[model samples]
Target chain A: MKRRDFLIGAAATGAFTAAPHIWRKDTSLARASNGEIKVGVLFSLTGTTGIIEESLNKATLLAIEEINDAGGINGMKIVPVVEDPASDPATFAVKARKLVVGDKCVSVFGSYTSASRKAVLPVFEKRDNLYWYPTLYEGRECSKNVIYTGAVPNQQQDEFIPWLVEKFGKKFYLIGSNYIYPKEENNYCKKLLEELGAEVVNEEYVPLGHSEFSSVINKIQSTQPNVIFSTVVGDSVVALHRQYRAAGLDPDKMPMASLTTSENEVAAMGGDAAAGHFTSAPYFMVHQSPENERFVEAYKSRWGGDKVTHFVSEPSYFQIYLFKQAVEQLAASDIDPTTIREAVKGQELIAPQGKVHLEAENLHTWLWPKIAMAKSDGQFEVLRDSKEWLKPEPYAAYPNQHCTADGLVQS
Target chain B: MEFFLQQIMTGLSIGSILLLIALGLAIIYGSMGVINMAHGEFVMLGAYGAWAMNAFFGVGLLPSLIVVFLGVGALGWLVERGVIRFLYRRTLDTILATWGLGVMLQQMIRLSAGGELRYVEMPSVLTGTVGILGVDVPGYRVFIFVFVAALFAVTWYLMFRTTFGTKLRAVVQDRSVASCFGIDADKVYSLTFAYGAGLAGLAGALVAPLKSVSPEMGTTYVVDAFFVVVLGGVQSLFGTVASALMLGELTGGLAYLWNDTIAKALVLLAIIVLIRFRPQGLFVSRIRS
Candidate 1:
């Protein structure tokens, strides 16, 4: 046989030998002798979303490195199997499958977008594995195999809308990227506005990666809304803010209040355009706490002094410790998806954002919400912070729908 | 009536940006029939060049445009000479190869600069607004309109009124015949490609302040630029301008009436219908061979 055929035969034989090890119901048994726990790190290192997701990847790695350096969890070093999904949802599913099935990671920590999370959901569910998601997203999902360590609508928008209405005015203009996250956010905003008898001047959605915002700015000018509630993400965030500034709209009169605008976007938008705009999030890099101080210091030292942390990266960093805490609660050999899921429940970490609890009932994190205004120096000034950790209510708008320990419950 | 003028002004500003992006593609694909898929990457390089000049050397955006143009234009020349030169006639292969080149450029930039958003500060002089017809228009946008017009005039002069223009057009029409006339078709094509790439770089530099400078930012511009170029007759420069303005006005008008998402859908539908009926596009060239 030729060399190609011979290599193919050898690969086939190697696969046949590795089959039993992979096919085992509990693949952890196969790696018992290694003294190292394998986990997967799935983040888009390249593509349209890579600009933001790259920071998330660095944060996840920084956490993993810190854990390994600190003697690790029960003497087993976490070996992260890093994979780049390249910002595509289909690729996210493929990489997720590789992490759960091929590498047999005890758990996978990844995904910044709702689309990516939804894509990887089936992979974790089918294999009965755990996946830790770290990003503030549109709520309404309750997956047993996924630990949501990000803020939902209640954690972000619940007190935010009332505060905005009180501070700004009754008239609001809603603008967002044409995606599920923004659409759902607008839905929740509308629901809250209806409750408060606030008027929605107009609502508009732009396609993702849309850079031109002249027309949209015109609409905002014409409408003359007191506050602009925006859910625009990615490159569009920078474009919208700059164009809004260019159109001579004063943020003091009608600031663009957003759930998506973070330090990362502000850095891109420049201080002039982003100044006076407000962002509602669970965490800002400038949050005053010992944990945050250490986190910012460490992240800067590790990634470089210029590297900035945002709301999502904070969760990406802390969720690893939550995992370590969860795993340490159980014996080495006794660890698996079901046991770890139970242990990870109710696990609380003093994250940079502050004391956060992984909700026992729904596998979602309870985070401290805060409202901040972007300063001209590319940082946020915290205006209001929740006095306590807000519980994660995944289905806040749909009053009849609830995510319980058993699963989603609908009346 | 004021709102209508404001809408029209906004449309014109949007159209100016579209023209900035499409002018380069029109020069390359329109004249040469070579599908320059890496054109967007050329734009991306220009943005990065602006950022680098600002970050490392303290060169302002306006001052850095000349350097960015030459730098990106030189790289375009290298690409045309090394790879695109050999595959000039093979349209399908050029598309695939250039697309691969675009991807390579993106990855290369990501590795070098790190995949984070970079900001370009707008000139202080251009930060204010200009009032026209009782509407306050952004000074930077007004500058763009004037700059695009000047660039278009220069490009037009080069294509129609210069010796290089005659030679380039002759080479494009019949490479063999141009070679027989001692025009050096290879030289004309390479310079044409470089100039087109340079125009794209100029567009990118001008836009860097308005949009975030990132590796993938070019992808956003490229798609819209293609729409403008195709909807305008691929061979006609005036057609590109007309289509860009028309699309801009349509989008602005429709978006004002309804929403952005619907406006984009309708504009796209209109383009599709127009393309189906008139494949040669809105303007048909009457030049005889």
Candidate 2:
């Protein structure tokens, strides 16, 4: 069969017979004098989240290339056996197993959405491998086999939500994709909103790819809430925001804030349409920092300036270096899970977003979170910045019940 | 009372978009039995065509509709003549071939367009909301409701009153008899396929403003269109309309009460129960094979 047909067959079946991956014996991830170190780079190169995941994949490859160029990892070159999960959870699991059993890579680095991460978590845990996931997500999750360099729930919300509440009114509306991240985030959001004596007027969940929001918009108009807290991701973000704007609801009057919307989405939706929206992230392309400026220049020179890099791509780029730093710290000929995981605990990097240090216990990172308003130029105007790094709370510390303004239990 | 009216209006508008999509599939897969899997890709093409016209030539949405109809319809004609025409008798092969053809088209657009979501701006006149029954209804949605009604009337007239429609229906029922009566079956099939494709393109162009234009944008639409076509009965256009209305209203009302994902699950279950009882659809034609 032709090469094109072969790709279609593989995509259709989720796994093809002639993948050309030699069924190698499950070997150890040891550095050899003559052999190259293979690292698994699995991400969605195609599918629903492919557009954003493509940048993550590039960031991983660039970091690996940079490491290999800098005299290799202890004089042994690192090679990546890339696999495409195609944004399907089952396909992600199948590829993760292949990376562990067939390629025998030291660790895998990828996954943008939480569902994909959860799917591959068992594979890594079962085999005692490392999966470096670098996207800020809904918190309350920690796996012994995964290094989550992304900001957790508290790190993203503490600085931004309070500021928003102070600036806007006390009433809020929650909108998001019906998934783990959005649901969990909205749950945490409701608790926090109530704790601050704010009222959550309405909460709604739509499927991931849902673009039609007329009925929902009608409900929004009638209710006329203070703010719309959104965790909606992917193409639906563009759809919902565009439709919301078209329906004559001035975002300036009733702002829409999201944990997921970033510079990448702003660029996709055009500045004119997505302008005035609020987003909180650990890193923004418009951030003013010496390290960020240099990193942005390097990224632009490598991959044209037209392409925008967000928090996920930045963390993804640094996570690979974080891996290399840990491996170099070991200074041993072998690279295994235990050594890498232990070394990663206290590892630090002067990443594009100032500094990131992995907290040992939770395996989460301590990084600065900033808030920005999207501009029509497809960039952001940084409105708020936390000068001090917030501690990572994998599961936020909060009372189960919400307290009203009078110090009485609301429910 | 206002809430009930608003919900029903929402359902009708949603059903109109579904009708626009399923109408084309009714002609191709319903009557023609070709199972054109690339129907959604045809919608994507029409969206892109509208985007290109507006960006390059400063053409507005109304004029672009006509251009997209002809352009995409012509492309459909070429595909039917070159590929689908040969595999008409082989059901399984036709399904697989169309499926493969769809993947190729998706990848081809992905490679050329770079896979980022593209937005098509709405015209200024359709951007605001109108007060209806003490509620604000989106203007573009109201436009879609009216536009679909007019299109349906025109389609009905063309099918029932025109010579071409008679020839097309004759070829569909008995190809040899139609051939014996000097009605060229080949021309009828080709025109019928092109017309169905043209309708899909129109659906795409109209929805481009509300939905972002991406290579995979058609996946959701095609799935919903298939549900409408199959549950409504393969051979009846009115069946497509009635089924789309039922499914659309059920989804909107359920989603308004619950959430979108749950409403979608319930709708699928409802269709399953529906098809179980009425296998021949809501309206079955009495024509003999």
Candidate 3:
């Protein structure tokens, strides 16, 4: 045999030998008998987003455990196949493809970024599989194959702009990490702010993962805007907050709000620095609801009482339940991909955040957003919340706005 | 015009950081002909050392800088004596080994710091702004620019005007010849590596207050340092400093007009064009084989 063929044969033999050894002996051969359904849980477990993803994964597992215990989704156990993407977008797509095509999962709930979700979009589209993305992203993309359970721009920025104008007046400073999400979000924010009579003092973009903010902080101080509107992501937010505090700028005096900062950031930034900051998201740990209380208690019980849960974690937790509901409703008769997709679009469930409805037209969810003021203990005190679930306007319908309703489609 | 000047100043401050990092790399590569891929890790170590000093000893910025410099210098010496000495003749092996070392060091840092960005407090005196000509500039950046320039002068004097410097140059010129003449080439090489690594650590400690302290922060500067070294000529210190400043200015000025991604792409394109014209770099001796 040629060298290549010999190498391939050797690799195949090695894999065959290793497979049995690595396989768990306790693996139950008792497969799903009648109405059981399997869903995939894909999250980053070992990379940059590991800490947050770990909490999300715990929440998801907790939800699954609770569902399974409570009659197992219409008397059939809801099985979750967990996969780690290792915080790589490409890996997310690969794992997503395998979950849908190989594992034959009814639905896949995954992704933490627009990039990661975008990576798996094509895979989901090609297979016409249902993907429930749990992270808030740039609003302008809607798709049939995906259910965006997170807040879109209109769900977030629409209320944010009017509220800021009413509370803080008309001057804003726009700062964000340089990426498609931040850039697009900031652009929409600026346009909205302008239309609402707010003047953007200055707009700045820094490289993602950039931590230095002395220069930018200096610029902000000089500009002295009414408020700072930020779209910065990840650990960069921690750096920005630290620098802002070090510069001696009081958040109360010249308040800054972010579209990105959530309970996760407050935990990372610690209570002292992140306190008094304003942030908008669809969920908060301190939401006063029976479902939310149960979620908080269960999450704390499973992932340690000291671990802080965030908006993203709650939504991710809800996605698994949503998937469970869809599978049970559809899987009783069939367990094919098409049925799962249809079931997901048609499913509506009471989540911890609130009652969320998946829009059949766009596959985006209608959920209410809460504006919270951060307390000293790294938790939010809900200052204001929408009384009703805001209908997801995925496509922009306004004539003056640059985007349209069709522009929001993801695929 | 004021905005343009302010951007230039900002670029210069940023370039000073690149210069400090590239200076260490150029010295090690010049003296030993080994590409110390772990140079960025040394810088990272220095930042951590400063953080540790603050955590343990309660040292402020000035004292912490000194502590990190000496601490990381000792670490560099230990690394050279314990690990780097064995792979002197094999350049590729040294590069690969140091790359592994870098990864190990970063992971160790991650295990300790937990992958979150932490802030190092800047000295009160260095906080605020200064008027430069007609424009307002950050006081910390102005301090950095002045400090790096003084550091460059001191390094230049030490390399060209001292006995140790003479021995270091002798080794770089001809190691076998210098050894035959009774010069302790190995000792010089080890000391040079330590000193170069120490400088890198100093740069890291100095910039920690200005940037976030995380395990992977060093990776960001390492790529830019490579470009600076390659563009400046590997063996020429002056060339590294000049090119680093020029590249920083170009990128910083353009960032004001365009997005940061496009600015970086433009810098990379300029470097590519430069390479096509001058393969030996702008300053290195073109010795034909």
Q: Cα RMSD to native, each candidate? A: 5.6, 9.0, 7.3
TM-score winner among the candidates? 1
Kindly list the per-residue Cα lDDT of model 3 for residues A83-120, writing each as its tens digit: 99988999999999899888867678788877888899
**Tens digit of lDDT per residue, candidate 1, span A271-375?**
888999999999999999999999999999998999899999999999999999998998777777778899999998799998889999999999999999999
**lDDT (0 to 1) per candidate:** 0.91, 0.84, 0.78
Model 1 agreement with the true structure over B1-289: per-residue lDDT tens digits: 9998999998998899899999999999999888988889999999999999999999999999999989998998898999999998899999999999999999899899977777788888998899998999999999999999999999999999999999988888888988999998888988999999999999999998888888878777888899999999999999999999999899888988887889889999999999999998999777676
Evaluated on chain A only, model 2 obtains a TM-score of: 0.88
- TM-scores for every predicted model: 0.92, 0.89, 0.84
Clashing pairs in 1: none
Worst-scoring 10-residue span by lDDT in model 1 chain A: A24-33
Best by DockQ: 1
Candidate 2 docks at the CAPRI level of acceptable
lDDT of 3 at B205: 84
Q: Which ranges in model 3 have alpha carbons more than 4 Å from their true place?
A: A1-36, A200-205, A210-225, A235-255, A266-277, A286-290, A328-337, A340-350, A373-381, A397-411, B1-5, B52-62, B123-139, B146-150, B275-289
Candidate 1: true interface contacts recovered: 0.74
Worst 10 residues of 2 chain B by lDDT: B129-138
- Which stretch of 10 consecutive residues in model 2 chain A shows the poorest summed lDDT? A401-410
How much TM-score does chain B earn in each model?
A: 0.98, 0.97, 0.95
lDDT of 2 by residue, A18-85 (tens): 54233442233353325576789988999888889989998788788878888877777888889999
